[model samples]
Target: MMRREFLRGTFGVAGASLLSEVATGLSGGGAVVAAPKSKITGGTIDLREFHRMRRFADLSMGRIAYVERGKGPVALFLHGFPLNGYQWRGALERLSPYRRCIAADFMGLGYSEVPENADISIPAQADMLAALLDHLKIDEVDLVANDSGGLTAQLFVARHGSRVRSLLLTNCDVDENSPPPAFLPVIQLGHQPGAADKFIAPQVADKNFARTDKGLGIAYTHPAQLTDEAIDCYFGPLVSSPARKEQFSRFLLALEPNLLVPIRSQLKEFRKPVHIVWATDDIFFGVEWAEWLDRTLPGSRGVRRVEGAKLFFPEEMPDVIAEEAKALWGVSRSPGGSL
Candidate 1:
């Protein structure tokens, strides 16, 4: 059925008539019920088409789940911990007009499969990304990363500087000594046998700020804007499979005791044009860390904030991110660039 017809049948004046017609048609071995096309939000773009989308490539780890769309210079996105590439849906929509935005579910998150007994360290994740790029025949691309993915992106650029054209980092843990207090327990637990899994499992559903409940207001600037459906989308993957929670637990454990040692010595020399986009009210990785990052990375651009945005700025202010990315790409802002 056509999209308008489908919508009309599902939620329009002829709802009952359409349902009866569809049921009778199906019963009589006629046309099958056609699913409605997923609608795009903000009249921007349809995100359902991108979730767990696949690419034909043979990397060491096999098929990976990534969403690649638009057509221009390639812009690669890596999401933070406890979240998947789905977090980039809004940003992707805004930037798609000017770039071929590719967002991937890092191994063990979203639809990507984590290898059993594989190294879950930041360096290992960087290597995986490199291999995937080689397999896909992508020589270089602009890199945008958030949270732990920022750390991973930095490591990747440090290891493969030639492959990175530019960098955009947001609210990520950059300083080794400044790990969030909320994550401290997880770090400590990883040192103990079987402690990692136990700690992360319960906290997955707590809905409290990772650092402190007090920061929830800052993290979620507009808490009322959040809906049950949105929360479900964000948290569903954590509980989607029995192995997901365990795998995530292992990944977080692998990150403890500092995951940046492999690339620490090289970060000071990473002179790529880097932009530090941060939220002023971030609770997890505070704004102070952004200053440290700017000072440490030579010639790094200073910090910029999304007014009233939280740690999850990609979701909260995708347009702001898109505008920043567009400026980085040296393009004029498009109609959808403003949040």
Candidate 2:
């Protein structure tokens, strides 16, 4: 079935709204720049399409791999740690018709190739994003992020608030919530030698293991439904080589010392429209954090709680993200198209 038809069938008209035409001046910049529309509009995106469309931007840090689709204003998608741009594949597919969605792999993760000594800290990741945007000639974006990506998004707002038009954050770090106590065990393991080989390699080697509590399964609402292809795409690169494993370990260790604490003042000062979506069942980030964000951000639109959803719920339930993103972007359905 066509992507639009399939989404419409799955979520009624609300889903089809994702593909409808958007207003020309939604970004608050001048008119939205036009780009070629997608030719293929059917079927789900797979590993093959991911590889075929992947592009790279060489910066001072290293090679950053990313995928871009859609047209009009840009919406930058940030993925969680231990995962990459593939996490937002569903969001990219669904929202492409309305926005130029770009999902980039952070350094030391996914397809982004960085030096062995590269600093993969959260702040550094935010800097890389700024450089990436500059390279792409994108002046502003609607930020959509999850997990550590949310943390990075906050830092991005703190340092480069002018470049952001809006933000949509899912279950992630906030203020003292950075490196939540529940994540200490993983950080400890990451600090150990050969952590990736011991903890990460096994998950990639045994796809079923990834669906268990011992692996990625702990974060997803429906781990059993996670495909083998996704396992390879998400975990394969983490343990691809000794350097990659070390980089992955460094990424976890860098999360310490609570980077978001100092940014509270900046968050309070930010006046851009913000939305916080939290997963109730997520043990790492509770609903209180979302409430905290709503109170902290002056322009916060408020929080949307997802009952029983886990940390990675955004990956499984892209429709919810689409709905929230459309609402945040001031997109409304009309007989002519979207406004």
Candidate 3:
């Protein structure tokens, strides 16, 4: 089903009214009323609670949102743009039992705030992440990144190789010169004044699939399973902040030019063990990018394709990511080799 239809069915009028109130409050005219907290289900994880529950560290650009759970080797998760650390909700739950899991919402996304006139480029983001790690007193971590976060991960490893134990990338575009076609318009809009508001406002309500919501729905895995409350939890933040929208636009535009130079200079120098996990049917970025990344990085193992998954493979196949991460870290049940 389409995302709009699902929202209509699940939220009805009352939920819509709540969303309206949230939007109005963000505009500074209405008194903000905290919504009643939803009950947390043990079986199904909620990233909103994870974000809301944590205390954030003030960074160079903004307040960095992060959560640390469990113990052992640390695992740091970085998410893509338009989305936040919430993208790792599934992987965080599955992997939390094995190791310390750290997930952060990048500036201008989720609960994190973007300082005025701050640089939201990939390198800056990598620096912010490093700063966050320093603040948390973490010296090393196994990095898992998706989409644009993948680029940030690469920058981190390139700059500070000793800190990374291993690398896990899922459905991210790593090539500097080649970016997805769907991203071009957004990038262009970001460079132009007021263009982001004109372009992104209308489409924020709908599923962002090129063909059908089916492609987008696969990322969630359970289409009918998503409640209106969940949808609101995801979409409300973006609609609430106009500044966030503007910063996000700048972020999109800055990604390509800012990252291209660093990635080109440092990609070959990266010697950490790298694993690329890609979805077979992703419309935004294809498997070709993964192949190129694997070939370029000297320590890359290879690319692993997840069947019936899409761009958001971590969300779609969390178990697979957890299993791969375990194997990559050499923490398997078997004595010393492959399981």
Tell me each candidate's TM-score. Answer: 0.75, 0.86, 0.77
Give the clashing pairs for model 3.
Answer: none
Summarize candidate 1's per-residue lDDT along 173-221 as a digit string, tens digits: 7756435654564455445554323543333454443223221223444
**What's model 1's TM-score?**
0.75
Ranking by lDDT: 2, 3, 1
Error of 1 at 94 (Å): 0.8
For model 1, the stretches where C-alpha displacement exceeds 4 angstroms are: 1-47, 52-58, 188-218, 335-339
TM-score of 3: 0.77
Best-fitting candidate, scored by TM-score: 2
**130-167 per-residue lDDT for model 2 (tens digits):** 99999999999999999999989999999899999999
Could you tell which candidate, 1 or 2, scores higher by lDDT? 2
Q: Estimate the overall C-alpha local distance difference test score of candidate 2.
A: 0.80
lDDT of model 2 at residue 18? 17
Looking at model 1, which ten-residue stretch has the lowest summed lDDT? 22-31
Question: What is candidate 3's CA lDDT for residue 253?
Answer: 76
